[model samples]
Target: MTKRDIFISLALMCLWGFNFSAIKLGAMQTDPILLTALRFTFAVFPAIFFVRRPPEAIRYLIAYGIVFGLGVWGMMVWSINLGVSAGMAGLLMNMSIIPSLAIGYFLLKEHLTPYKILGAALAIAGLLASITITDGSVPLKALPLTLIAALSWSLMSFVVKQSKTKHVFAFSVWGMFFALFPLVLFVFIFNGTQPFIDLPSQLNSEVWFSILFQAYPTTLLGYWVWNRLTIKYPLSTMAPFTLLTPIFGLIGSIIFFHEDVSVLKLLAFALILSGLAISQWRPKKVEITSAKLKSECK
Candidate 1:
């Protein structure tokens, strides 16, 4: 990555890290599902008018939108509202790697290494530890809901790969159009006409700030740069940077929400990050040392 690109990636990570805080902010004001619906609504229009829809992606668009919007984000916002802290929500979302790897291995015939297996084990241990946290951060029901968010994230990844669309940014933006459907449907079913009827009153400055932040910088601009980076570089190079997200999440949570980080939580963070590091590990180019050169010389 160039210095410019590297800076951009770091910036995106920071925005994404604080994205949880933004979600919590809006979710506090209104039903999270409706908030998420509004998020995609703004994300799609105006921009979607300009970016051409991804070609031959109707089915893919539908599936991706629903999973990406409602399943991944809606559930996530709800989980946070249910009492899962922003820091924990960000960390838990990274667990999507587990399901993503599994889907690749079992369904897509991707190879899995022993390191990945060990890493999965460690991550699972960390997950178990996370659930056992009695610190009022991770509520019992919130655990399963966030797990669903993680799973949905992986499923959307699968949809993207399966579609094999070159226009990732357009696909994402257009797919988000579909995402609005499930989100709107759920919002209606759960809260009826009240939330939408009251929508006019809910558009305070703080709420608008949260919504625009999530929609523009966090979702549209963020994914656009990220997709460009992924296309320019191998997945291996891009993968490790995400490890910083949860770290940033924790830091942001402490600064904004003043969420306490306990000893056990630290252990869980260590185990989970360690596991991810191991799983995401790829072999580096072997530069022969003097000893290795001597053996070859011999």
Candidate 2:
């Protein structure tokens, strides 16, 4: 990767990292479900009017939207609001790679290497370590919800890989469109019209800034650039940069939320990252199925 590309990757990582702090700020002012709905609202409208829809099945688009938007993010924001620390949430979310790899093995018949198994074991052990952190700082109840979020993200990633969509950004936009309605319905069902009615008055500048930042920079810009990079470079070359996300996540949490970083938390972070690194290991001559297509730098 060129220095410019490296800079872009670092910027994307920072955006994602700070996103946890942004979500935490927004959660303070609005109901998590409602905040989620509003974020997608900005993600979908205006831009969707300009960006062409992806040439994929409507069912797939809807499924991606539901799984990625509702299942993953809804659960994530709720868990954070329920007291899951932003840094821990970011670290736990990385577990999505495990399920994604598993799905690839079962469905895509991708080679299930011994390294992956070892990595999975290490990750599980790390998860166990995370559970033992009974330091009253971490919320035990929110962990399951965050895990569910990661599981949903894994499923979403599988769908994206299977679709083999050429226009990833378009897919993201349309997916957000489809996701918006369900999120709206969720807000209505759970929080009802009261939050919506009071939303404008309730929102302070910081909360509004969080919502806008999440919608534009975090969702639209972040995914667009990320997908484009994946197209331009090999997954192996790009995937490692993602490891930086949790690191920045932890730093951002400490800076913004002043969250405590315990010893066990540090161990869990190290082990999980090590597992991710191991899982990403591929033979030098190995060809990735997804990279079969030639890259088109537009």
Candidate 3:
């Protein structure tokens, strides 16, 4: 990768990192599920009409939509609303790698390496440490919800890998389009019609800004740039950069939300991140294909 590409990757990490604060801001004002609906609505509009549909079967697309949208993000936003700190949520969500590895081992007949087993153990320890928090900064109940988001994301990875979709961005747009309907249904079901009926009056510039940030920059641009980089670089080179996202997430949460980090939280962060690094480690001589990298981009 060029210096410029490295910079771009870091910048995207920051964009995604701060997105949690953005989601938190939006969730605090509007209904969480409704806020999610607004996000996918903006994500799908104009762009969805312009983008071509992916070559995958409609069932796969809809499955991607449901898992990506409601299963992953719906639970994430709701967990944040339940008082999980944005930084912690980001870290917890990355634990998806753990489940992905496990699922591959058991269901897909993949090998479970020693490094992966050790990594999983460390991450589990970190998760256990998280349960001790009583300061109310990180809600114990919300932790499980975030873990569910991680599992959903792992499932999404499988979905993307299973389907032979060549158009990454187009597939994502269509997935968002399908995701919008269920989200809207969730809003009406849980939140009632007034939020939607009064939507125009309810939206302020700050809220709109948050929604647009999450929709355009965080979701679309982030995925696009990351995918482009993955296409250009080796998977070994590009994949490691993603580990920085949760670091930036923690930083963003501290900077934007003034979140205080505890000693246990720091230990958990260290264990989880260290385990992630170990799991993602590749032998120095192995080369990976662009197709593999593309499939990994969700």
- Number of the candidate with higher TM-score, 1 or 3: 1
Looking at model 1, the pairs that clash are none
Model 2 clash count equals 0
Alpha carbon lDDT of residue 95, candidate 3? Answer: 64
Q: Report the C-alpha displacement of residue 123, candidate 2, in angstroms.
A: 3.4
Kindly list the per-residue Cα lDDT of model 3 for residues 1-298, writing each as its tens digit.
5779978987987788788889888887777888888888888898988998988899888998899889889999999889987777776677676667665666656666676667667766775575465367568778777888888877776676566567889878887788988888887788788877767776898789889999999888776676466545433344334545667788888998898888877877677678656755655544456556777894
Looking at model 1, residue 124 earns an lDDT score of: 69
The most accurate candidate by TM-score is: 1
Model 3 residue runs over 4 Å out of place are 1-12, 109-111, 225-243, 282-298
Considering every candidate listed, which one attains the maximal lDDT?
Answer: 1
lDDT of 1 by residue, 119-238 (tens): 777876776686577378888888888989988977877777677778988988998999988898998888898988888898898789889988998889877676666556544345
Question: Which consecutive 10 residues in model 2 have the weakest lDDT in total?
Answer: 289-298
| Sort order, TM-score high to low | 1, 2, 3
Tell me each candidate's TM-score: 0.86, 0.84, 0.82
lDDT of 1 at 244: 53
